[model samples]
Structures are given as structure tokens and as C-alpha cells.
Target: MIPVVPLDRSREAALRALVDGKAKPLGALGRIEDLAVRLALISGREDPSFDKALLLVFAGDHGLNQAGVSAYPSAVTTAMVATLLAGRASANAFARVVGAEVRVVDAGVAADLAPHPALVDAKVRRGTRNAASQPALTPDEVQSALARGAAVARRAVEAEGFDILAVGEMGIGNSASAALILHRLAPAPLADCIGLGAGHDAEGLARKHAVLAQAAARSDASDPPGVLAEFGGLEIIAMAGAILGAAAARTPVLVDGFIASTAALAAIRLEPAAADYCIFAHRSAEKGHALVLEAAGAEPLVDLSMRLGEGTGALLALPMVRAAAALLSEVASLDDVLAGRL
Candidate 1:
């Protein structure tokens, strides 16, 4: 079990006082104040620093694509991974604007990826088995993926000195996998969890719905690990592991939309304390995202109609996180302002 320590709330009152003491009226900063408090609480510091942020985008293929769940082919997953590595994808552009570094993890991409410094080759296998036909991952593969994900996050903090972590994913037909995981674990109905992942048409959506129904029927597992192993894409499970790992290290993780939120749900379900360290980035245009966010009890920072995953939402939200930290560290207290101690 990952030893995810519960966030300490002992500093709440003091943190609130600090925020209220800022050279502004009470609640003037709005949700930023809440965000600052959360950052402080996560770091256990009155002046938390989010100067260095890392976005880990775990990429993989899903065997369930064979079942016609996605509008795109499995090959798109590889092409997207290449695009990300070439610094040409939407995620890379957003990351450049946000000043957060992006690293792609080969959790289980179907094709062999040439080594890139920014790519962490943690492939457990060449993708997972089709959940509609069999369990997506074996118990052992699940554990390994979880471990590698945790290690990646831990190293980011302990070795690379990043102050914050975020997670995204790339996998074709993985939305079907995420929906299945969310349906079983969120205990939401299967219908509620299904969405127009990667822009499915009416017929495509119907096919995805039917395929997910078949996968859901094949597994009755309600527990976190069991549910993940049964329906998770390898990248999805690795993203959960990254969440757990970040929480274990006591670093806040900015969770990206629908797919990443599903991973966060699995992580929190596996280790309840992990929820405290997650910052749900944004709601997406994806239909099922709202339900997943609701199930996770998360109020995201923005809703830009964004559904282009690969950490784009989280990267866009990074400035707000940086601003929150600045409010705590740079803003002066009202008392000092009044005393002309600026």
C-alpha cells in the first residue's frame, strides 16, 4: 500500500489568517485565496512555492480499439506521442505558454518508441488486453504500473526538485477504458460514464456505449485495484500510480480532464488520503467529465470547453497556481501596508 499521509489541517486557521491579512479586503482574492490555502496545506508551509511544475503525460494503446470504441485508430496514439515528443502537439504549445515542463511516459504504447530524454520508457507491456474480452491488465501488471508511476513522481520531487506534479494521458479507445473504470468505481451508471471521446459521431458513440457495456458486464469488481485491472488502459493505471506517488511525496497534483480525473478517482479510491493533494484542473467539453468531477467532489479551476487532453487543461491552469503561490509569498499584509512598512 502506498503510504499517502493525510494532509495536515492544523495550519488552517493560521493560513486563513495569513490570507485574510493580505493587503486586500476579506475574500477579495476570491477562489485564489482558497487555492493559496490549499497549496499551503499541501506543502505544509505558510509560503508555498510552485515555481517548478512538471506535467507527466502517460501514453499507451488500448486493445479495446479493435472493438470500434474510438473515432480514431490506435495508430493515432503513436502519432500523437510522436507529435508531443516533437514539441508540436497542442499539449506542448500549452505547456510552453504555461512554463511547465512536459514529459511523456510510455506506459504501454503498442509500438516501440525511440528513446527521448523527455520520454520515460516505463512500458509494462505493449498496451493492455481488451477489456471487452478479458481483464485489461493482470494483477502483476497493475502492481508494476502503479510502482513505476509512483517512482516517476517520487523522482521528480526527490531527484529533479519539481515543486508540483500534473498528470495526462494518451491512448486510443482508452476513453472507453476510463468510462468503464469510472462507472464501476464511481458507482455511477454505465450510461453516465460514457462520453464522446476523441469526437465520436452518433454511430461511433453508440458503438462505444455498446462495447463499454460488454466490458462492464464482464467485470463485477468494485474494489479499486480490481476495477482498474479489469477495465483500465495501461496509461490510465500508470496515471493513477503517478497520483498516488505524488500524494505519497506530499506534492500537489493538478489532475487534467476526464481521463486524468478517472485516474485520480482510482487513486483516491485506492488511497483516500491521496485526494487531499489533487487539484482538479478543469472541466472539459467531454460529456462524462462533469460526472467524474462530481463523483470526485472536485470543483475545477476553469471550463474552457477543453477536451484535448495530454495535460493541456492542467498546463493552462498552472498560471493560477503560480499566482496563488505568489499571493502567499509576495503580497504584503494589510497591517504592514497600513503601517507604511511596504
Candidate 2:
């Protein structure tokens, strides 16, 4: 695991004091106050600005889809990537409202996506092998995927001047893989981590149990990277690395629900320092999400029963994040009131 450059704590006490100095009564903003503090710490400044935002939808395929784990077909991943590229997905709608740029990544789609300006071709492979009986990706492929993921964030933040990043995935059946990954990383029981991913029915859930049970038994991922390489979808690995990259750049990273949280957990497991950069965007309708959120100690910014996995939750939360940053950077301080400033 690469060592993460830790968030600077020079302004830790001053930052909180400054947040309290806002014109409102202390703690009046609730979680919005927490969001402001977090954004401040990530940027390591008393004032943090988030006028630039990005939504990266990492698309991949899950070999678990070969089994009946999800209601949607595996082909839906590619089609949805196309939908995202066309700016017709739910995430795009939210991005439009929030004024965030949306970029689709071919992290590991089984099919070659047609060339599009909005798509960043960072595919590590066609898809991962079914973890039920085999490792998802070879160690080399996993390393490559992780590197690619980190590169995307680094490029955006360093070269393109991206301020905040929200990571989402478009892998059909990835929730099962996320469950498996969470089961290995967190102390929760395997059954506690399993959920009805992408609208599974009774038979589909039964199949999920049978196959994921086999995956748990077959996977021996003792460490964070091992867990990711052995059981994670390519996009999941990439998202984890992206979180790491954001932390390295000292930029806030919005973690979406369920599968995205699974990646956040992986990133934190890899380097605990990354947690400071993460702002969980929402809670998902999928079962076991609360448990994962608890394990990560994340209080989501919102909960809309949203289970759509395309950075939609993060997009919906973007405006709120921007507002928090705006308050930190532009809002009046108690000093202004003392000076009789309007």
C-alpha cells in the first residue's frame, strides 16, 4: 500500500472556531456544520472553496452477474455507460442542477465503449472473474486498476483544477461483490453484508447467497489490497484509489452509497488517512448499508431512499457541499457583527 500524505492539522482548532464564528448560533447547521469542518480540514485551510466539482462514474462488469445476483442483465452496464455519456442518466440531471461536470470512465466494461468526449478510457480489463470460485483480477491487474484509479484523480486535481470529486460505479451485480468485499473488510457477518442488489427477487437472492457463500470461502483476502484484488470489481478498486488520490491532493471526496461506500471502506482500510477526505453523500436503500456506514463512522449528508448507482446521490449532495464551502470561505464572521457590518 502506498503511504498517503496526511491532512495538515495546523488549522484544526482555528477551523472549528471559525465555523462557530459564523453569524448563526453554534451548531445551527447540523450536519452542514460538520460538512464545513470536514471541507476545511481536507483543504487544510480556515476557508475552503468548492466551486469546482466532478462526478466520475466508473463502469465495470461483475462476473457475479453470470449467476442470478441481479435483476438487470450484465449488458446493462455498457448500455448505462452509453446512457451516461449521452447525459441522459439520473446523475446527469442532478449534475446539471448542481453545476458539476460529469465524466464517465470505462473502468472495466466488458464491451468497448464508443469514443466519446465525456468518457475517460481507463479500463483495466474487460471485467473481473467471478470471485465465487476465482480471484476477480490477478494481482497485477488489481495493481494496475488501483494505479489507474489514482491517476484519474491526480490528473483531475493537479492538471484540470478539480476541487471536489464524487465517485460512483456502473457495474451490474457489483453490489454482491461489494457485499463480499465488505464482509471480508468489516467485522460484520456475511449475511449482514448481503443485500438485494439492483432489485433482486427471492430466487435471485437465494442465488446470491449460494454464490457469495462460495466466494467468501474461496477468497482469502487477509489485507485491504488482497480483499480488493480477490473480490472487488475493477471499478470498485479504481474508486478506492481515487479516494486515496483525492486525499493525497487534499481535496474533498464525496463517497456515494453502498458500492461506493464499499470502495471508501477499502480506501480507508488501505490508508486510514484517506477517511479525512471522505464525505459520505447518502445512505442507500440496499440492506447492510447502515452497517457499513457505521463501520466507517460516516454520517451521510442525505438519505433519499436513493439506490441508483451513478453518482446521483453525490450529485444531489453537491450543492449542499458547495454551500458549506461557501459559508466557510465567504460567510460573515462574528467580528463583522461586532464591527456593525451588514
Q: Candidates' lDDT values, in order?
A: 0.91, 0.87
Error of 1 at 328 (Å): 0.8
lDDT of 2 by residue, 1-342 (tens): 656877777777788888899899989988888778877877766677787899999989988788777889899998889889998999999899889999998889999888899999899989888887788888888888888999999899999999999999899989999998898888689999998888877987888998989888985676887888888699999999889888888888988999999999988988998888899989999988898898898889889998888998988888898888888888898889889896
Q: How far is candidate 2 from the true structure (C-alpha RMSD, Å)?
A: 1.3
Scored against the true structure, residue 258 in model 1 reaches a CA lDDT of: 94
Candidate 2 deviant stretches above 4 angstroms? none
Q: Please state the error at residue 85 of candidate 2 in Å.
A: 0.4
Model 2 is weakest, by summed lDDT over 10 consecutive residues, at 1-10
Model 1 Cα RMSD, 1 decimal: 0.8
- What are the TM-scores, per candidate, against the unseen true structure? 0.99, 0.97
